[model samples]
Target: MQRFAITHAALFTVDPQDRVIPDGTVLVEDGRIVAVGPAESIEIPADTVVIDSGGKRAVLPGLVDAHSHSSLMRGVTENMPLMEWLPYYQLEHRALTEEDAYHSARLCYLEALKGGTTCVMDMFRFMDRCADAAGELGLRVNLAPYVADQPGKDFFSTREENKRLIRTHHGSQSGRIQVWMGLEHLFYCSEDAYRDAVRCQQDYGVRIHTHACEQREEEDAVLKHFGRRSIGMLDHYGLLGEKTLLAHCVWLDDDEIKRLADTGTSIAHCPISNAKLASGVARTPDMLAAGINLGLGTDGPVCNNSLDLFEEMKFASLIQKATRLDARALPADQVLRMATIGGAKALGLDGEIGSIEIGKKADLVMLDLGAPNLTPHEVTHAGGNLLWNLVFAARGSNVTHVWVDGRCLIEEGRSTQVDEGHVVATAQTCGLSLYERCRALDHLRVDMI
Candidate 1:
């Protein structure tokens, strides 16, 4: 087993205790954290590879993206509401080939690593190809194939296909990659599909992920379909459980919030995507107060246009404050926790990978503070100020290194495993072809109208 030591750096554990160790050293042996303490206390082994951070960096647990689509549709659909956006997104999704999915996964993973996100829960079509790309790129991915079945058969996967994917890819990538049962939305799926999704989750011991209450239209559709709201309907169908991770509870009411808290369900809050789509701000402060485990997510490259969780954290904090008209809504430390420990809790990986504790996997990110935005530092309120700077000032460019399971996948602000140039070229070509196809379909729709 290989051994490595990262020494003489500032460390933010984001643990339950919220410990920040100045001039800390973390020792990793065979992909697990063996020791973490002040640099003066820990003895460096002669055979260990030492990473000298020169006290110019702040190391923290790698950021976890609790929800994402991993599609190359960044900046594609715009100025549309949920109902209109759904059909347009579907038209574009139908244009995705296996190669397109692969390249998109590569591109998304590259962006994620560069932005200091080490783990992601990605829901997309053609997930086998996505899984392959994540495996090759050494990304810690939880892959959920989009499963939707409706009466019209416009764009969705059937129940049988969802089961097949779960069987094939669960625990596939040496335990680095996991597959979950997914649905695009409750309205897009039949009652039988919902039941089968729950059954698959029980049988395979994996999580169920889906979008719920993203917009008022979604809520109205659920009410029209079942004479009840989406959360109540999901509860009636046995879909509300501890293993469920619901994305975007922006339109949910107090009753829905109570239901989620009572059922121990998790939420992936995407403030940036919500704002960009003109979706209402999620009541994250209320949800957190109600004991809901809230994690940060970028939603998708298409809607969010970037996978930077630091930006998401900043947006999450500012939006909550602005919406509530209360400055104390989401503080810097709370936002930092939401990006690290809160995300791990929502993903059900809290026991293994959230903080820099001994016996935990060494998934870490190093941010260089030598830049202009981070100078004139002060140690008093350092944790709070460090988090504020990270959320408000830092970008993907500030992330110097990223490690997952003690393996260096990103070094010096670049992906070590994937070819950035080739991935970008392929995504560009595929995106152009998709645009042309959508234009042709628009003409057909116009003629029909």
Candidate 2:
């Protein structure tokens, strides 16, 4: 077993009690945390490699992006709502080759690692290639193939493809890559597709991920088609459960919120995407109060434009406060929890990887505080101010190192497994090609509109 020791750093466990241990030391053995406590208290074994944090960096559990679409369509669908955005994104997605999908996955993982995100639940096309890219890059990924069984040629994967991906990639990459049942929308899928999706979940014993109540049009469409709201429609179809990670609940009503809480469903609240697309803010604060498990997500590259959870955290807090007109709406500590432990709970990986506890997976990230943005650091409230500075001001550039499963995937802000230059170039080429296709489609749509 490989033994490593990270010493002399401030630790933010983000546990239920939110423990912050200054002058901390963490011991890792065989990709699991063996001990976490003050430096003077934890014993150092003889063969352990020591990484001296020098008390200048804050060590925290790595962030989890509960929802993401690893597409090459960043900045392509700006100023469009969900209905228009969906078709536009579909046009872009239909142009993605297997190589393009791989590049997009690489780009997503690189951006995620740089932003202190160690794990991501990615819903996208060409999921096998996405899983391959993630496996090569050493990132923990839950790959969900976008499933849409509608009659449109723009729709990519069918229920058949979704099941095939699950059977082939359920536990691929030595258990690092997990496959889940994905749906483009509740409306896009036929009743048979929904039944098969449910079976897919049971057959693979994996979770179901899909967009829900993202916009008013989605709610109206669900009501028009099924004579019920999205949440209620899902419940009526027997789709509500603990294993479901609904992407957006922005248009849910009070009863919908109650239904979500009662059914033990998890939510991936994409504040950045919701705000960007003019989709009303999800009642995250209300959902949390109603006992719904809420986690922060960056939605998709086309909508959110990036997979940076740090920006999501800040936006999650600020958007709620601004909408609610209360400065204490979503506090810094709460937002931090949403990024780490809350996300883990949503994904049902809370006990395994959320916090820095003994016997847990050592998925960790280090943030450098020596920069000018974090000046005047004082432990007045045992790093409360530090947490504030990190969530409110810090960016991906402040992330120094990232470790997943006790293995260092990123060191000195660089991915160890892949060439960053090559990955960026490939993604850029794919993005440009997709953009041109989208532009052509837009011109064709102008006549129809």
Relative to the unseen true structure, what is the Cα RMSD of model 1?
2.1
Q: How many residue pairs clash in each candidate?
A: 0, 0
Residue 346 of model 1: what lDDT?
82
lDDT of 1 at 365: 97
TM-score of each: 0.96, 0.96
Least accurate stretch of 10 residues (summed lDDT) in model 2?
440-449
Q: Model 2: C-alpha RMSD to truth?
A: 2.0
Query: What are the clashing pairs of model 1?
Result: none
Per-model CA lDDT versus the true structure: 0.84, 0.84
* Runs in model 1 lying further than 4 Å from the true structure: 380-384, 443-449
Q: Worst ten-residue run, lDDT, model 1?
A: 440-449
Q: Per-residue CA lDDT of candidate 2, range 1-449, in tens?
A: 89999998889888767888878899999999999888999999999999998879889899999999887777766887777766666665556677778888889888998889988999888888988888877878998888877665444677778788887888877677888888777767776777777877787798888888888876887788788888877787678899888998898788888989999999999999998888888888899999998888998677888788888889899988898999999888888898998898888789888789998899999988798887766543256588788789888888989999898988988888889898898788877876776676664331101
